[model samples]
Target: MTLAETLQTKLGEWKPAGDGRHSWAETFADSGWAVRIEADRTDTLGCQVWEVALDRVGQADASLTLSAWADRIAASVTGLPEKLKVVEIDQHQSAALLRSDTPGSRGNDVLYFEVRLAGLAKASIRRFKSEHAIGARREQIPFIITHEGLAKVVGDIAG
Candidate 1:
C-alpha cells in the first residue's frame, strides 16, 4: 500500500488537498498542537512520502538546543528503537538514520527521522527506495513507520 492509502486506513478520513504539492492531508488538533499528515507528491508519483508536520499553537521555548530537543523526543517516544544513533545534527535540526548494526538489514529498510525547529517544531519519518543518501526518491514498498508512532512524536513535541 502507498503512504496515502496506509494513512487513510490509520487516520480515518482525509480531505483532498487542492495544493499541487500534496494529494491529500489530514490533521489532528489539540489544545496547543496540530499534527498534519500529508501525502507529499512533490518528489515523485511512484510513491507519496508521508510528511508529518507538528505545529505549535502557542509560544515555544526556542532557546533549547536542537540536540536537547532530539534527546527529549527520543526519551519520550517509547516506540522508537532502543539505541538511536545520531547520524546528523546541527543548530536547526537533529536526525537519526535508523540502520541496523548488521549490513544486510541496511539500505531500503532503513528509516530516517528528524526533528527540525524553525518558527515551529516539525518531526518526520520517511524511507527511501535506493538510498536515503540520494534523496527522498519514492519507493514501491509500504511504510514500515506507523501512525501511532507519529502520534507519540507529536505528544513529545507538544509537551
Candidate 2:
C-alpha cells in the first residue's frame, strides 16, 4: 500500500475537515491546547508540521508553552539522552528544529517558530492564522485545517 493508504488506514476513524486526495489535515482541541497536523505537502517538501497553542496555561508563558511542547516532541522524535536546547541562540525553536539533524530526524519534526516573541504573558491569548490565499472579501475559514484525512496518511509516512 502507498503511504497515504497506510495513513488512511491508521486514522480511519478521525473526523475529516474537507481535504481532497492531494491534502490531509487534522486538529485536536481542548481547553488547554489546540494541536493541528498538516502534512500533505511533506512528500514534496520533506517537512511535516505539528502546531500546538497554549490555551489554558494558568501561569506558563505562551512561548514557553511552545518551547515545552517542542521539547517534548523533539525528545520523543529524537530519543535524545536529554532534551536539547530547542530554543537556540536565534531564540527560536522552529528555526533550531528546521536546521537540526538529530538522530531519527527524517525532517519531520514539529515546529515551534510561530512563537518567536520574547515572551508570552500569562493573561494574553495569541493565535496564528492559517491563510490560503483569500480574495479581497472572502470569509476566512475557521481555524480548522482545510484538508480532511491527510494527517493520518502523513503520519504513516513520517512515523
The prediction achieving the highest lDDT against the true structure is 1
lDDT of each residue in 63-124, candidate 1, tens digit only: 86556665565556554433333444554443433222222225454443444444335555
What pairs collide in candidate 2? 7-153, 19-148, 24-150
Q: What lDDT is reached at residue 64 by model 2?
A: 56
Clashing pairs in model 1, backbone N/Cα/C closer than 3 A? none
Candidate 1 lDDT (Cα, whole model)? 0.45
User: Scored by CA lDDT, what does every candidate get?
Assistant: 0.45, 0.30
**Which stretch of 10 consecutive residues in model 2 shows the poorest summed lDDT?**
121-130
- The backbone clash count of each candidate, in order, is 0, 3
Q: What is the Cα-based lDDT of residue 143 in candidate 1? A: 39
Name model 1 segments beyond 4 Å from true. 1-10, 13-30, 39-49, 80-83, 92-111, 129-142
